[model samples]
Target: MPVLIPTLVFRPVSTQLLVTDGVRSVGENIRDALRTHQDTKTLGCHVHEPIRPYWPEDAAAQSDRIFTGRYNGRRFALNVTGGTTLMALGARRAAAEHNVPLLYVDTDNGVIITLAPDGSVTGEREITVSVPTSTYLAAHSATVSAREPWGKAIERRESWLKPFLEAATVLGQAGGGSERLLDVIRPVCSGGAAGPAELPEVTTAEESLANRLQEFGMIEVARRGGSLQVQPKGDERIRQFLTGHWLELYVYRACLTSGLFDDVCLSVDIRRRTESGTVVNECDVLTTLRGRLAVISCKTARLDHKDENKGAVYELDSLLQAELMGLYARKVLVTNRLALRPPLRNRAGLSQIECIWGPHLPDVAQRIQSCLLPGRR
Candidate 1:
């Protein structure tokens, strides 16, 4: 077989177009996508920027220049996988005029289709591509400032934290019980304790649960005047095991356990500079699979009906902002709530956002697996 040299000649649409359209032009996004594929060796990357990116003549002229100047007398193919309609038209015209092979990617189906010089479909095949962790970060204009492999971290401490997580689940399900429980424990954990007289009355089951916590050395208990005085050990381990950090850690670990993602980063702080100034966003969990990106936002707060609507809007906006960094990036929201309101669900659906609530928390890995599956997007 003759050696095939792949030169990715693409166009970068104007920044104004990207901002107005809420996504990077197809050409820019496809370049990143192609760079991630292991089988694709890019010999050269030529970016054609037209004065009027929306004009076919300008786009076509740029394409012709690249084809004749750099790709001339070379065994190459023209991939018109992205860009505006006029941009595509320009590239198609150049390909037909030059008798170069034309190619297109069915992104929705994970297939690469080949077209004859005349623009007829000649053949196609499915392909699996994955982005490296470093490449993923670079694509988002982010860096790995710190690393916390939540899955491995939790697995190392699961023996002790398992019971704590179970207890937390019980308290969490008691509606206001979790907050009350935390209130009772915070003072004790801080090296202070309420007198028995100042303690709240507890049911037999609540008392038993307290005893379990005491046995774990997470708290101390004193009984006086038929009331239970509690003090927390205030250990870092105890705090992390009991607080909302537990849920966030659980979600991260779940994603790691799925064995689906090529890369996973927990607690990523992404900073981007704009004309005005620099802006920063904290991502709870970031993962990449099959060359696609997914940003998972984990929440433990219970929002009321009105707050739920607001929360949905806020999350959607955040996801959209993240999308600007990585076009085709998936948006996911993970929460402990039973379910998002119908309106919230509808809004998420329209935005291509995935909402995972309490019941689905444990199945996050499977959900992510499904999201990364070919043609699922």
Candidate 2:
């Protein structure tokens, strides 16, 4: 038999365009994209630190930060920013030199330049940008608009919502949010394609809820007019949406510890560049339990807990961060499935590792609450 070997290339210059007409537009767009792409399994952005190889100060050295992941099997990177003229010019220049697309989100709408391989801009394409109404803007424009403290709270929430919006869009699309539900009703309803009937009746609250559902990869807009119609993508979307709340509970449950130790906050992956010019991505959870900094490296069944040689389980890596946490701190690994080796588990200098099953969140939460209480053991 003839032998055929598949070739793979690890490094190739590939990029995608991301832009929104304004802050709110960008937020909405990102939210939509995130929901749409969440269900393809392991759907999350892979961030990298800025790379400046032989870059002069005068030259463009910094690449705009991007969030890259898969959507419908197509790869895209979104570059979201508040409007700035200098950044706009830089984006255009970068697109031409590197052969990437550039999207500009402005006050009114978004402008994108589709580039050729040689880096010449194609025809300017404009897309509708979602923005808050003028009345809403006027109410929020002043520093002390309406209630003195309310504006700040609103701003903070908006800041958080922007990123979430993008995540929702990607997940929503992947999980078949609308399509899943639509399939259930398509046969029974009067119309052969009875997708619209599957959606809830249109209302302000309903629309907002729909948007939120879209973020979770549960439902999507099938048709929009005076009354917007929604439909499910598939069975997976329905299952994912129905179980999302439970999944969140499962995450909380998995992280919870037993009897003693309080103050638990769900940790997420955060990436930053080191001074040594190396880009590093960290996967850990950090919390202060009674002024003691506890840095935990969490793992799940879905996650691979091994390095190259596989002689030593990878839990030892968590200790390196403990050294960085200093003497008044601790390091631990939280897992529902994987168990560590004896020597590593029996170390006197290290804290006892903790594990919680998929069903044990309440116990973990109680333990965390106990840890945080004053004068509690």
Q: What TM-score does model 1 achieve against the real structure?
A: 0.69
Clashes of each: 3, 58
Q: Counting only residues 3 or more apart in sequence or on different chains, how many pairs clash (N, Cα, C under 3 Å) in candidate 2?
A: 58
lDDT of 1 by residue, 300-349 (tens): 65554767656755764664564455555678877666656787777778
Give the TM-scores of the predictions, in the order they appear.
0.69, 0.28
Best by lDDT: 1
Write down the lDDT that model 1 would get.
Answer: 0.58
lDDT of 2 by residue, 59-146 (tens): 2334323321233234332232332445445554544455445333221222333445344545544432222111111111210121
RMSD (Å) of each candidate, 1 decimal: 7.2, 24.9
Candidate 1, residue 66: how far the Cα is off, in Å: 2.2
Task: Give the number of the best model, judged by TM-score.
Answer: 1
